[model samples]
Target: MSFSPAAAHPRYDALLAEWCDLLRRCQEPGADGAPAPDPEPYGRDLLGRWGESQRKYHTLDHLQAVLDRATELTAYAADPDTVALAAWFHDAVYRPDRSENEERSAHLAERALPEAGVGAGRTAEVARLVRLTVTHDPAGDDHDGEVLCDADLAVLAGDPAAYAAYAAAVRAEYGFVPDDAFRTGRAAVLRQLLDLPALFRTPYGKEQWERTARRNLTTELELLTA
Candidate 1:
């Protein structure tokens, strides 16, 4: 079902307002004299997508959390607005059973951002940031991408109760898969994260989240393997 404002997320209104302001700032006057596109419809569409029935973890709350973290790390971002926009659309096309969710979400950003008046260069940057979430491995020089990726992963460093809830929500999202298969797949993903040279790319992220994230991932991996 589509998201209705009244029944939708608690943060939906604030997020919509924030997007509207961001899009308005990014809008360029049309060459043909067409009015600048409205951000309200675009924001509403994204909220509806995030509010879809199948999404248990990739909801507005997750988006808000990422945006909050991105805001906190704005000093490290080349383009803070682009990072925030990327966070908005990174999981916009989520499908728990699909491996191409990040790619599809990036494509969605490419298609929709221009219509919302985001410039071509900035839109491409946003799409690149969204795609980077697939591996959470931004290029060494990509400051904005690193911030966005780290923000998206900040939940891994949350306190134990919050981390447990995050895990539960993820499991709920993949409820279509059998428990045995889900556990196996999840453990593999955790192991891969643990095997990474660094769980977070930015100095801020490394200092603030790396150790806690590794601890949480190791603990969860053990449970999954057990």
Candidate 2:
């Protein structure tokens, strides 16, 4: 699915609604029988962060893409709700020039989810899942992690035109970097992805995305090096 930059905020409300529903499921009941704290504000905060000027690829469009893929592969996740939460926070603290974005985003999830009434275990799981995006390398048996990691990478499997658009968006995000520096850095990242034994961890992701992802990566690498 292609995303228009103009529609980002409108689309965020739908994603936020889905997140609120998931948050409600993960909520623990209050001792006095009160409902758990609402997560809409937190969702809005995250959406706002994703809409920042420094972000071009890691916008609401990217979040929605990952969330949609996670929902489609929900049957493969051990905890779909946690995976969904992780998706919301995965790029929450993005900075195109920064290396610690994943760690920072995970920290944000750790700090925010529990206060909003998510259980400790679930909160930890969400943070862990967010951190896994730093490598996109989940353990073989970690189903939820696999699902989340694959979802984050699902854009690699898009059609050629969509993949081209994604590459342009990413380049735009790093517009601060000089052409030579950007090419070297971007090429290194693509090569690392190419070197991975498998790009998609979950069976569903492997079946649906692996080949196309490799093709897209190879195509981009050629353009970068050419």
Candidate 3:
């Protein structure tokens, strides 16, 4: 399929146009624009620099998955602009070697938004929300962040069959690992997910993601143990 902003998200067609215009203006040299970088190039560069496993984890498909969920939860979001920005930049810079990939991604967003005329304060808030994806902790005041994180993780809570396919895809991305080590690590990760109080924290996420997530976790865990 062609990568049309209209095709992937009909609802955001207008918003996509607006965003593109904004990006293009920013791209213009010395046109009173603050010289903002093209986010698409940033996305491309990040993916291009990634190792195999990180590439799969931070793939365009994963971004699309999170963006889809973020769109669904946007109706209930009070500050959807912040949520959407967080969704776009949350995984902007992913480095598997470091535990601070979220922090770095947030930093990139912080730097990029101000140049694009998004106020510094609002940019910081969005960056905070992007960082919050790492913790995936739900708080009364952080409903939007929770929803975004849940959406980011929805693949884990998706249908068992699909989740199994995702797991295999992930394993393939990490094909360097031995079969026994991969099975052990994968099972451990699934168990950790099963141990969480709830797969999705926000009301919307809980309603939409809990069952499938649990099913996926359980199936994987059983397969690992057996």
Candidate 4:
């Protein structure tokens, strides 16, 4: 995606520090204990990707929100740092018109994480978690997946105004689509999410967000159809 000056996030420094800290925890020293590569460049690249112009909803602000939510949900994740990393790469390759953005983002994680000195297993887990964003239907026992998915979806539980703004921003991202088509696709998405047995897997998420998110999705779906 192309760079967008206006989409730049205000908390770049804080976000970078967050990324660097997470990366440092995951890094494995080189042969003979050589230090891992600096995490700043990788954090900068990810920040740039999140700020890409074609995005409206998937901006750096969204990234920071997800990161914060993921951190909040770490109590449910078996590997909190890995969940943090997954949060960083989850939408790193977002494109409104592209269906394979999740896979590509996962691939990007697969390639980048190991080079950043993360262990192979953690890198693979990170990529798997990124791909899971496609369905956001993590199995019951998938702790990390549950946290990542819940964090990614926490925006749905926002108050009416924030939720409305989120809907508008999403519409703006797919501006290339005709109004009718966008409504149809967006309605289907809401229905799919609504059809799930449970929207949020973690105990805190279920108690805090599930009902609100369902209400929001139902309202959005009704509006889209109306």
Name the candidate that leads on lDDT.
4
Runs in model 1 deviating more than 4 A are 1-7
lDDT of 1 by residue, 1-226 (tens): 5437423577778888998998888777887988999899998888888888888888888988999999989889988888888998999998888899999999999999888777899999888889899888878998998899899999999999999999999999999899999999999999888888888888888999999999999999999888
Evaluate model 1: give its lDDT. Answer: 0.88
Report lDDT per candidate: 0.88, 0.88, 0.68, 0.92
Instruction: Give me the runs in candidate 3 sitting further than 4 Å from their true place.
Output: 1-54
TM-score of candidate 1 versus the correct structure, residues matched by position: 0.96
Worst lDDT run of 10 residues, candidate 4, spans: 1-10
Candidate 4 structure quality by residue, lDDT tens digits, 42-115:
98898888887899999988998998899899889999998989999999998898999999999999999988
Ranked by TM-score from best down, the candidates are 4, 1, 2, 3
Clashes of each: 0, 0, 1, 0
Q: Itemize residue pairs with steric clashes in candidate 4.
A: none
Model 3's alpha-carbon lDDT is: 0.68
Q: If both were scored by lDDT, which would come out higher, candidate 3 or candidate 4?
A: 4
Q: What is the TM-score (0 to 1) of candidate 2?
A: 0.93
| lDDT, candidate 2, 63-114, per-residue tens | 8899899999999998888888899899999898889999999999899988
